[model samples]
Target chain A: MYIIGELINGMYRNVREALAERDASAIKTLARRQVEAGADALDVNCGPLSKDPVQDMRWLVEAIQSEVAVPLCLDSTKQAVIEEGLKACRGKAIINSTTADTDKLDAYLALALKHRASLIALTVDKKGVPQDKERRLELAAFILERAAGAGLDAAELYLDPVLLPVNVAQNQLEDILRVIGDFKLLTTPAVKSVVGLSNISQGSKNRSIINRTFLVMAQAAGLEAAILDPLDQELMRSLITGALILNKAIYCDSYIEAYLKSKLKS
Target chain B: MAEELKMITTWSQAVCEMRLGAGRQEGGSRKVTLTVGGEETLPFLFKEGALPHTPLIAVEIFDVPQDDEPEALRRDLRGISKDPVTWAKAMVEDIGADLVCVKLAGIHPDGANTSAGQAVNLVTKILGAVDRPLIVLGCGEAGRDNEVLPLVSEATKGERLLFGDAVQENYKTLTAACIADGHNIIAESPIDVNIAKQLNILISDLGMPLDRIIINPTIGALGYGLEYAYSIMERARNAALSGDRMLAMPFICFVGQESWRAKEAKVPASESPAWGDQRERGIMWEVVTAMSCLQAGADILTMRHPQAIKIVKSEIQELMKKAQS
Candidate 1:
């Protein structure tokens, strides 16, 4: 599974203050912690609250790259901010988001092609987030068509079905779960699927439990990647256990320990 | 539109190479050395990965004469079997066996009851008889093998001899001796992956690096549960390639011993007219067992019959050439 550590963002208190005071150490610490917790990449967002997102994106990219060698998920709603973040990335990066709207999809598709970076496209279009599996598939078709038109293969595309808070959209969870497997069949080599792991329990009382439960269930539904808080010990352990259960990795007596040791190295 | 069908090239993380025998400068008195393992993919899969070293064959020559031995085994070595040294020389000079496996059956208490000192003397004479690498095997008895094999291991201290029959109960003694004597070990398990892994874990716990240890997940001849043996070996190889360090070493199969034990190899034509000639049937039994094991990733095959060994050796040559490109 591909894990994008969702910790270094302006929405978080520490990251917010770090960006305000230009404290690179704070960003570095968060970057190091997530990578140590088995994050294949770190999702960095300037948040909607940033007065100058392009500059903040550049600074966040440089700070995280300076501290850790992992790839950065250049996350932003603005095309310019994502472009600026891409410029500062030293290695392969993931463009955090593009929705299914024609103009938005076209711009991100061009950037993805030029930078040769993977893209994570949300199922919601300009009309708004889909509430049913059919609408989700419709948006997915548009995004995948636009991506392929620009010569981006299935491997370079990650389709997210736009997770919503479980307390409000309880029925949508099943809808998303039902379509996760179908997402893989949409292309020849199989397009990758990811979910914003914490979105399911955004306001729930049992946040950690809900997140861990949904992550494993999503995995069984062919969700091969996630934007999650890697530092959540229970959630990370659950991910490893789920992988073993899926027969994705060979099991040994010391499998968890072995997994962590290899994670630390990578 | 015509879609071109292309093959996929997958790779294993690592393939460890095990060297047997030491020359003058390295340690042994042999004129040449033998190497096995170091294959990156499934055996004989040229499209997938590498076949670094061709599988080596060592002829099994026993220390004592077998008056009641199977007729097929006794046919060629009948007279030479009187002495270990003569039989060993014949295997290397006549049959061109890569190495001579000296099975010290005479030392087993259940049979000849030969002393450990006598076993050492036989090994010394056999080493002098041939310039090829020698593998010293123990009788199946655990207590007796543990006792005699270590002494034999110590006697051939610098030859880097690959000694075996190191079962779960008897591995510590042999591993410790190999650690001290600068030789190698063959850890034998009873055709089970768990026991095979446990045996490897035990040997590794004794500070014997895996590269110095070859695994013998016991075999079953064709029509004699050979599939069970194949399945166990395939799983071990897969686990090893996926980073199970304990199982990443080379594998050795006792083809001659297991194949000859089957009734079909020696079943009388009078009893079953369709069974065919005893000699040809027996040789084919060993050949098929070796070939099936090779496909399942055996790095070394030890056989008793000269004709079977010759066939397997030439097959290994052709296989290696076909896989190189």
Candidate 2:
């Protein structure tokens, strides 16, 4: 139920326009809404698409932190973007990524250690997103080893198994969940796990419905964090309810107060 | 009397565990949260073992004109039907609903030709007007949902919303937004047990928790293949309870959509004498679908029709009572 409000990213046309025009109002609106809605952290992704990702991510992070108290999940594939995002972050932030690839892992882990930022590790290596759970687990194990060598705490590491669309491979989903279930046995107990929420519903009709249902299932499989849009009420409610059932929260009693406050601010 | 009862053989459990509530002391807002797992003790085993949580019932509200709806139900929603916000508000205030499920049918590419921003604005308006938990449903169009959900996610941000109808294809953008924005997701598969399990697996592949996922095995109305869906969900739940981790998340059924779409719910009274009164039939249609889903292991049932909601809620109360006793 740790909602990471994803509105500040520059991927959408509106956000892109706002970022390009330096429209602080639009950016501020998104930031405030996400915080109010229920996002625990705001993921700031100033990808290469932005004019200056480093500077833009830094500015976006600062702007969001000023208005909302939620932590930031700094997202970028570039080492430079991770560095700048880390530098700009006010409190402890989450590095949006690192791959199992040795070279990439070396760089990203260094940055995470340097800034004491939590890391989102992708279970993919020199080969792109794996097609099966075995490969995913192999890569995840490799990444975990490298992370351990780098002296990163298990709790600070979040593993992303990489959800592939079912249309491509019917069994692809089964493989992925198997890996998640196996991760409990494979990795240390303290290690956290998460996923980029969009991958499973790729190319399907009724995408939102499919995405939300899968998110609930993933939560069942022990996924802790998700890279998703924090604004959808249906998705948010599912997250709240799902977290309560999992006993992830204090006493499973915060629904009414939290929901009301979210609406009031909105 | 001293003889030990033998354990009954059952299908292997395949349900997954889903977690809710992220970043509390770890740094976000919100004092408390909850998560439900997809696990089942043995599909519909109310008498045999513990059913940790009772199924939740959600009331459905649509953004489209219901000219086709029966006069009885329409009368109750006369003024509200004109506006989505009013209708949603009524679902909460007048209907005693647990969750408000707003279907953005008007924004589908095939329907209103609305833009993503328009859909976002409509959802925002509705959210602004209600305090209860919300479930935003997209028209079952993959491309259109991708177009609208991200914006909707951006618009709602952090309300801990549940967005849906995510299928095997076209889930990336919306799923990404849900993950980024900290919302829950619904993984919908065709009415097949394997397919349901597969979708859950794929979503978890992205590092999303099973607790954050809800499985929709695809619903069917009373006669239009209800038994098929029922059996499939039953099998899936049995698998979860039997220890299969993939199918463990709580189940959701689009009762309103499935039941309302049937000919029985839509056809006029004169046209089908065998069906009897259209209002009674329609309400029964929804109630029967909702009840069947509950029997098959539905954690949350999204329904239309006030009568249907009332009946299902009471039925759920009775079931809970029996279980507690």
Contacts from the true interface found in each model, as a fraction, amount to 0.04, 0.00
lDDT (Cα, tens digit) per residue for candidate 1, span A150-228: 8887888999998899998998999899889988778888888999989999989999999999999998888989999
lDDT of 2: 0.74
Q: What is the lDDT, from 0 to 100, of the residue B13 in candidate 2?
A: 43
Worst 10 residues of 2 chain B by lDDT: B26-35
Q: In model 1, which runs have C-alpha deviations exceeding 4 angstroms?
A: A3-92, A229-237, A249-266, B1-15, B19-31, B63-68, B102-137, B140-189, B194-215, B235-249, B268-274
Candidate 2: fnat, from 0 to 1?
Answer: 0.00
Error of 2 at B179 (Å): 1.0
Clashes of 1: 1
Tell me which residue pairs clash in candidate 1: B22-B28
Per-residue CA lDDT of model 1 for B1-325, tens digit only, reads: 2243266556545557899989999867988798988877777766667678888888888888866567877876678877778888888888878888888888888899999999999899888878878889888888888888889888888998898868877787878888899888898888877677667767766788768889898999999989999999998888777655667789999999899889988776677788888888989999999999999999889998989998988888877777654
Best by TM-score: 1
User: DockQ (C-alpha) of model 1?
Assistant: 0.16
Complex DockQ per candidate: 0.16, 0.01
**What TM-score, computed on C-alpha atoms, does each candidate reach?**
0.81, 0.51
lDDT of 2 by residue, A1-266 (tens): 45666667787778788778777778778988877766667888865588788788877887777777667899888888878878878798998888888998988888888898888898987768898778887888888899899999887888888877767666787677667777777764646678777767789888777779888988888777787876787887787677657744322133433333323321
